[model samples]
Target chain A: AQSVTQLDSHVSVSEGTPVLLRCNYSSSYSPSLFWYVQHPNKGLQLLLKYTSAATLVKGINGFEAEFKKSETSFHLTKPSAHMSDAAEYFCVVSAFGGNRDDKIIFGKGTRLHILP
Target chain B: GAGVSQSPRYKVAKRGQDVALRCDPISGHVSLFWYQQALGQGPEFLTYFQNEAQLDKSGLPSDRFFAERPEGSVSTLKIQRTQQEDSAVYLCASSSPREWGQPQHFGDGTRLSIL
Candidate 1:
């Protein structure tokens, strides 16, 4: 079984302030973790993915996430939040092995709101 | 040609009516997937196809849902007799040819409303 949890349902940040969206995962095998952002009525855009690569993975738009295995966490962070960063974010987990039944699991999501 | 595309951006169907959602994956991408996303909820996997092969459909809620990728390019997800509970955003995604750790490219999705 594989699952992910977004610790916060909604997060509010002021533009130019730091932002943090926490996520945790549960999996039986080594997993691939990802962060994705979706604007209103838009498809999911990949932010970053951790596939046993560098623990701290940087993504586009000044966003990054650190994969902490000991804590079973993959938390997305932005040094400075922008108005455009206000959107819903999802944490996802995929299996590392090629199991015929492997399925990716998504977190409930955290909606970010930015204030100028 | 640039990204995955889905048809019927929005559909409103009466209860018990059938609906079909179309998805066109990136050309030559072998892995395609369908998902259901309820309001404020994360998208849930419904099915996956590798080429024309329907490799996984266990996540589908019931037999009311059926999916086909006839020629390994375009796919359709048909809902037989939709219920109010069937209202959700149907998302389609495609990744490269691989079994694991492939980042999927997603479509804008088709919003279905069962009234």
Candidate 2:
């Protein structure tokens, strides 16, 4: 079974400080990993994705994640936290190939808080 | 181009009532997905449709949950005998090719409340 675990349920960062949200995944095969953000009353927005091509992936709003196969981790990071960055973040993983029906497993989610 | 759109932005149903939520995928998107997102939780897959074919529905919690994409462009999810636990935001997303690593565009989602 493929599953994603977000290490923190909540993370608080001061504005302009660096931010890190950790995630680990379990998959039978090489997996496709993604990070998504959701604002209040808004839809989930794709941040970045890792598809075996590159270990380091950069995404919108200065967010990035590194795919570490040995560690079974794909952690999202940002150089500085913005007030608008306060939102719910999710780590998701899906199998590389086979069936289109294969569902993407998601982490519970991490709520980011930015303090000024 | 417009993004995915879900209608009945909000729906409130009583127990035993049947409710239908609709989704309009982006133009030319070949794959559409429906997910159930409970309050304070990540979206859980419910079903997938490739064009007009309903490929997978293993994530559906019960038979009471039914989804259809008859025309391949618009999809509808119907829940019969709504339960209190079913109250949550139902999200709709669509992707271009239905392949791994393809980015999915999402709609705001319909907030369903079961009484």
User: Comparing to the true complex, what docking class would candidate 1 get?
Assistant: high
lDDT of 2 by residue, B1-115 (tens): 8999999999999999999999999999998999999999999999999999989998899999999999999999999999999999999999997566787788999999988
Clashing pairs in 2: none
**Model 2: which docking level applies?**
medium
Among these predictions, the greatest DockQ belongs to 1
Over 4 Å off, model 1: A98-102
Per-residue lDDT of model 2, residues A54-99, tens digit only: 8999999999999999899999999999999999999999886655
Cα lDDT, all candidates: 0.94, 0.93
Task: Please provide, for model 1 over A1-116, each residue's C-alpha lDDT reduced to its tens digit, 9 standing for 90 to 100.
Answer: 78899999999999999999999999888999999999999999999999897999999999999999999999999999999999999999997654643479999999999999
User: Distance from true position, residue A17, model 1, in Å?
Assistant: 0.5
